[model samples]
Each structure stands twice: as C-alpha cells, then as structure tokens.
Target chain A: MSQVLVVTSGKGGVGKTTTTAALGAAIAVTGQTVVVVDFDVGLRNLDLVMGAERRVVYDLINVVQGIAKLPQALIRDKRIDTLSLLPASQTRDKDALTDDGVARVIKELRAKFDWVICDSPAGIERGATLAMRYADAAIIVTNPEVSSVRDSDRIVGLLDSKTKKAELGERIEKHILITRFDAARAARGEMLNIKDVLDILSLPLLGIIPESEEVLRASNLGTPVTLNDPTSAPARAYCDAACRLLGQDLPMVIPNDRKSIFEKLLGRRAA
Target chain B: MSVLGLFRLRGTAPVARERLHILLSHERSNRGRPDLLAILRDEILAVVAKHVSVDHDQVHVTMDRGQIVSRLEINVELQHPANGPIAAEREKAAMTIVHQASR
Candidate 1:
C-alpha cells in the first residue's frame, strides 16, 4: 500500500521544499515509484528544484479544477523513471486548491505510486493544513534554532488535532528532520543541539542535514542535492533519512563540522 | 562563576526549553479542558449553596502543575445568615452533618 507523507515546517525558510525533493529523489533511486506534490500554491518551486519546471505544461490546480488530467500534469523525471512531480500553479492562490480537490488527487496518487509526498507550505494556514489533511505520516523539517523549534512544536500540536487521523482518533506517524544543523556551532553553544530539539519536540529524529554549500548549488542548478551531488554531506544525510523512512534501521550519522587536521596543525604552529 | 558560565546560564537553549514546556502544558490543558474546571466550579457551588449560604463570586478553581500528579484546588467562602436567625443554626448543623457524613 502507498503512504501519503507531508513534508512540513511551521516556520518559513526551514527547508521543507528541499527535504521533499531530496527524499523523493532518494526514494525513487531505490526503485520505488514516488510522486512529490507541491502544495505551496502561489509560491510553487518544487518543479524548479526537481528540474521539471520547463516540463510543467499543466499543474495541480489544473488537475484539481478538472482542466487537466493527472497523467497529463505529472512530470516524469528524466533521470529516475520512478520519480514524478505534481507541480503547483504559480499563477493561482491557495484558494484554487479545494479540500475535495486535494483529496481526489491524493487518492489517485496513492493508487498509482508507492509514495505520495506532499510538500507543505510554511505556516498553519489553509495551504499548510490542506497539505497535511490526507497524510498518513509527516516529516517535520526544522532548523536547529529557537524559533524553528518552537514553531515545530506548534505544528506537532496541529498534527495531533487538525488532521484526518486526528479527526478519526488515529495517530499520524511523525518524525523530525533537523536541517541546516551546524555541529560546531552547536558545540560552541550558538545553536541548539539535536538532543535539545528532540527533548522539546519529543519526536523521533529522522536525520540531520548539515549546513552545506552543496545544497545551495544543487537547488540553484534545478536539481535535488541527492541527485545533484550524491557524495556530498547533505545528500548523504538525505539518503539516510529516506532509508529510515523506508524502515531501514541504520544508525543516524551526525555530520561533524570540526576544523581539519591541517588547519588545527597550522593554527598550533602559528601560535 | 566565569563569564561564559553566566552566559550559559542565560542561554537560548535553556530559555527555549523552559518556554516550550510551559507552552505545551498550557496548550495541552487548554485543548483537553478549557472550560471544564469553570463548569465544575459552578456545579460544585450550586450543590454547596443549596445548604450553606456561599458567595457565588468567591468560588475559585485552579489546576496546578505537579511532578507526578496535577493538583486541583477549589476555594469557596460560606456566608453567615443575617440577624442570628434560627435558619443559621439549622444551616450550620446541616453543613456539619454533610461534611462529617462525607468524611
């Protein structure tokens, strides 16, 4: 059976979009058919990150409003045959996405794909709520910062109260993905450590994506980091997260940001 | 303490953790019982006032957070009957019996 998962973060700019694309691509690389639906209606950019922007002749709103069919709107990935994208309409606002319309699209996607990942917009408004309305599980993206962690706690409450599972009194499986984590900064007490975030949210840790320039480079080139630079730190972290999502019991690999041996030796000599 | 220790004492992590604790508790209790305690206070007041002259406005109910268990405190002040009337002794005797029988 297919699972509908929402990649969500209450605070903006906390990497909900990046995590969606990377996990979708990583899962697809494992030969699972995955379709990532962009739920950021007015600020649609999942297609750009997935390198399917030019191929988006029709979008989610078009399919929802009956102007286009699902097959016609789904942009199949060129590199990964099993990966696809349902791009959001940049021209339309969130009002264009009706609750019934999203449910229909999600049901259809669930029937066709092994994983249907919804890329939720920031905030707890209609756009974000609708994104998580049909999710069987949620991957909450958070930064190792005070505001992000606090907002994530709010989202956690919503996950318990405002979802269909919540309405039915069923549990929606939740996992926390800490992004933009700087280990050295955390050690210096500049950023919250992973344990601190975990203690506050009390959700299981998914994987930690270290702050890396490779993520910016990948997004700039219209590619997911996992596929763009598979060997990079962020990409490896995302890959591990995707595996964990697939029920693999791999130990989490926390990336270190300590100074290199050469740098430390040079600093000692200079001193 | 060193200056660094002072900064650590006032660090954002500790502050954030404490804030989230209070916020989450308030949120959880609000979600489960936003008006339940008030209704309960009113009901208890109605039952008590039937026998004893109690001030309706004096009924206060509060829930205090505790380590292993939450505490619910209810305070209600009883009013004395006017003019040393016979009804005062009867009401007091009834209240005493009610309290003792419950105990």
Candidate 2:
C-alpha cells in the first residue's frame, strides 16, 4: 500500500521542510516514486528548498481548488526522476485548502505515488491538521529543546485524536525525528539532550540529525542536505532515518559533531 | 568521572527536562481525561506530607488503560524516617483512604 507520511512539528523553524525535502529525496534515491506535498500555504518553501521553485507552475492550492490538476501542479525533480513535489501557493493562505479539496488531491496522489509525504505547517491550525488528515504514518520532526519537544508532544496528542486513522479507531504509526542535536552542548546541560527528548516524548526514535552548517547551506542552495552533502554528518543521519523507515533494521547512529580527539574519548567530559 | 564534572552543578537541561515532563503530562491528562491529574498528584503529596516527609521527586502518579481496565497508579518510595509516629499514622491514613468503603 502507498503510505502517506506527514512531516510535522508544532513549533516553527524546527526543520519540518528540511526533513520533508531530505527524506523525500533520499527515499526517491532508493527508486521509490515519492511526491512531497507542501501544505504550508501562504508560506511555501518546499519548492525553494527542493530546488523546484523556478519550476513551480501550479501548486497544491491550485489542485485543491480545482484550478489545476494534480499532475499539472506537481513539479518533478530534475535530478531524481522518481521524486516530485506538490508546492504550496504563495499568495493564497490556508483558507483556500478546503478539507474535501485536499482529500481528493491526496487520494489521487496516493494511487499514483509510492510515498506521498506532506510537509505540514507549524501550529495546530487547519493547514497542519489537513496535512496529517490522510496520512498512514507521521514523522514528528522535533528539535532537542524544551519548546520544540513540548510542541511535539502536543502534535502527538493531535496525531492520536485528529487524524483519519485515529478517527476510525486505527493506529497511526509515529516516529520522532530529532534534528539539530548538539551532543557537546547537551552534555553541558545547556538544553534538553537526546535521552531527555526521548524520555519526554516517549516515542520511537527515527534518527538524530546533528546541528551542521551544511543543512543551512542546502536550504539556501535549494537542495536537500542528503543530496547536497550525502556523506556529511546530518545528511548521513537523514539517509539512515530513511533506511530505517524502509524497515531496514539498521542500528541507530546518533550524529555527534564533536571531532576533538581528546574529548572524543572523554565523551561529554569536556562538554 | 572528570573532577570538574563531579563538582559542576546540574545544568539547565535537567531543569528544562523536568519542567517539560510535568507540563506535557498535565497537558496530556487534560485531553478527554480529568484535568485533576496535576492537582491530584499535588494533593496526594500534600496528604502524604502531613505524616511522612516525602521527597517531591520520589512520587509518580500516572494513568494507564489496558484492554479491560484503565487505572490511576501511584508509585511512591517511602522514606523511613529515623523516628516518628509512622506506623500508626500510616495505618490510620490507609484505613480512611482505602478501607473506608467497608465501614
């Protein structure tokens, strides 16, 4: 069955778009036909991040409103033929995304694509809800911080109550994808660490992406970190996350950026 | 352990983690569930405190629903104080809270 996955974090700037783009592209690289749908209307950036901004002719809002067909709005990845993007409208707000309209678009995409990944907007509003409405599973993108983790917990409650599967008494699979983790800082007790995040949310771990400059550069260059720097720390983490999602029983590799030879052995001592 | 690590005060992470843990649990308990969970935990601690000096961190009150039954389970680590009217007071409290229905 084609799985619809929503990449969501209730808090903004926690890398929902980045994860959506990165995970989608990585999955596509593995030969699966993936369509990443941007649900963050009025603040669309999936196109820009996925390097399809120039190619975005018709967007998700257009498809939802019947202004354009699903194929017309979907922007295919130039590099990865298996990857495509359904960009969100920049001028129109989420009010244009009616429930029935979104359901039709999602249903059509489901029949054609192997993976329909929705990039949800921040907050518990209409856009966020509709993004996860038809999802078979969810990737709760969370940062290792108090506000992000707490917001993720809020998202979790919504996933259990507000989603289609939840409404039908069916369980929706949820995975916690922790991003921008700074192990050194975590050890110093500067903010919530991996263990703290896992304990607080109590969800199954997906992958831990280390805080790295390449992630920002990829966003700026309109490329996913996985494609931009696949061998880099964060990119590797995303790839691992993708593989794990593919049911590959891969061991979890917590991305640690600290490379100091002395501190490496000490492991949180210098931190 | 590094000598400096041993001397260093617990960092902000623990404080943040503890706060988030309490906040999320309380928030979660409010959705289709009683809002009294947070209050109940505190009240239980207060009632228990009148007799035994219990550490606030040592108590855990949680709700769990199995296939057949949903229960509010309370787990507490009893601190055996050096000296006090512990046994009689505990028995009296237990009778009032748990055994009162029979009476």
Worst 10 residues of 2 chain A by lDDT: A262-271
lDDT of 2 by residue, A44-150 (tens): 99999999888888988888888898888888899899999999999998999998998899999999999999999999999999999999999999988889998
Q: What is the lDDT of every predicted structure here?
A: 0.85, 0.85
Query: By DockQ, who's the top model here?
Result: 2
lDDT digits (tens) for residues B24-69 of candidate 2: 6656756666544445657776888887776657666666432233
Docking class of 1: incorrect
lDDT of 1 at A122: 94
What is the per-residue lDDT of model 1 for residues A72-114, given as tens digits with 9 covering 90 to 100?
9999999999999999999999999899999999999999999
TM-score, chain A, per candidate? 0.95, 0.94
How does model 2 fare in lDDT? 0.85
Candidate 1 chain B lowest-lDDT run of ten: B94-103
Instruction: Show pairs that collide, candidate 2.
Output: none
